[model samples]
Target chain A: MVIATETFRPLVLAQAKARKLEPHLIVVKHPVGGLNAEELKERIDAAFEGLKVEMKG
Target chain B: MRIVNPTYGIAPQGEGSATAGPVDWMNDPIVLFSNNKPNAKELLLGVRDRLSSIRRVDNVDYIAKGSASQPAPPEMLNEVVRKYRIALLALGD
Candidate 1:
């Protein structure tokens, strides 16, 4: 699965389509920069379950 | 850390190229980073650690393009994907 920020979803999806791939993808909140570790960890944690599901799929 | 100001573009080979396709990250994935983005280093490290905790990943690698001014080399990335069959390109702010 590919995890990227929301703002980059278009570019990431475009690349995926061009390559004819249908892999699962996770879109995190946009502007994924300058966040403290706790905040970032929280974001990743929030998506962890979903990511696990995708990984298992 | 070594840094170089390069004049290059890392576009993947076209349709007929030998390495053209999407990689399956389920197996394993190499990582790419945007040096230009704020806190990129921290984010990259965090993501790797988080993924590692979730599961063990083999042959995991990363490419940091150093300060956004230097773009990543696509050919190198292509080689990695061809060899590893997967990649995680971390886009930035």
Candidate 2:
């Protein structure tokens, strides 16, 4: 389910813009497990259309 | 200047703990930030998905926290700036 809101979008977007960075790589981590740096890096290169399938199942 | 939504990560930290560690970058640029509090995985993942599709940023950094959290370590933020060179740091809630 898409949970992004108008308020959060601008904040996140503005952060990226200020940094002069490109929006491509996505890092996913749990509070306890930390992050699987390798897996997260892989997601960045994964196609957007396939992300849901890969992430969910 | 462009607006882009990028993926971020949430990792846990102890009280007074410093530094999140070295980040492994994808074939894209990254901006590392910190997130304090718990149960932030779903929210962060959703944000990442939304931002990755944008044509602006190549990556995002999200630091996670536990129930009782502390501010991000200055060294960590400094490392991010030193490593990435350009970054937008969001600390606390």
Candidate 3:
């Protein structure tokens, strides 16, 4: 699993391309620096449901 | 089914956009992103750890996108998505 902030998404996406690697990602709110661990976990956890759905496709 | 978070920028514009969509991982490979940020890594790792408990994902590959000089390479993205069934893009600001 991979996580990225909004601003860094382009960078992340580009890097993923350079190596030709495709991995699941969980995009959390930017400035994660502010969120406490628990809060960040919650955000990261939320992205999983979407992955779960995508997996079904 | 598709889920989009309208809160953040939905799509990139002007020399930085790609037509990424959902995929069926059961049939194809998956790739994750690492932007080289400590907090971003932590966040992605958190998701990776959580994913193990719910389902069995064989493996995930990490890729680099940009640096101080250039934006994400569009060609790289196009090539990466060509083989996969789905690409997960997270947007938060």
The TM-scores of all predictions, comma-separated, are: 0.62, 0.33, 0.51
Candidate 2 at B40: error in angstroms?
3.4
Whole-model lDDT per candidate: 0.62, 0.41, 0.58
lDDT string for model 2 (B1-93, tens) is 976558655444432422333333233345534354222353445446665655344456554433236655777767666666333222222
Tens digit per residue, CA lDDT, model 1, B61-82: 6666654766667876576656
User: How well is each residue in B16-65 modelled by candidate 3, as lDDT tens digits?
Assistant: 43444644455456555544444555665665676678655565544556
Q: What share of the true interface contacts does candidate 1 keep?
A: 0.41
DockQ of each: 0.33, 0.08, 0.26
Q: For model 2, give the RMSD to the true fold.
A: 15.4
Instruction: After superposing candidate 3 on the true structure, give the runs of residues whose Cα lies further than 4 Å from its correct spot.
Output: A1-31, B1-22, B35-38, B68-70
**B-chain TM-score for every candidate:** 0.53, 0.42, 0.52
lDDT of the structure predicted as candidate 3: 0.58
Q: How close is candidate 1 to the true structure, as a TM-score?
A: 0.62
Q: Deviation in angstroms for B4 in model 2?
A: 49
Local accuracy of candidate 1 as per-residue lDDT tens digits, A1-40:
5667888788877877767666467677876677887778
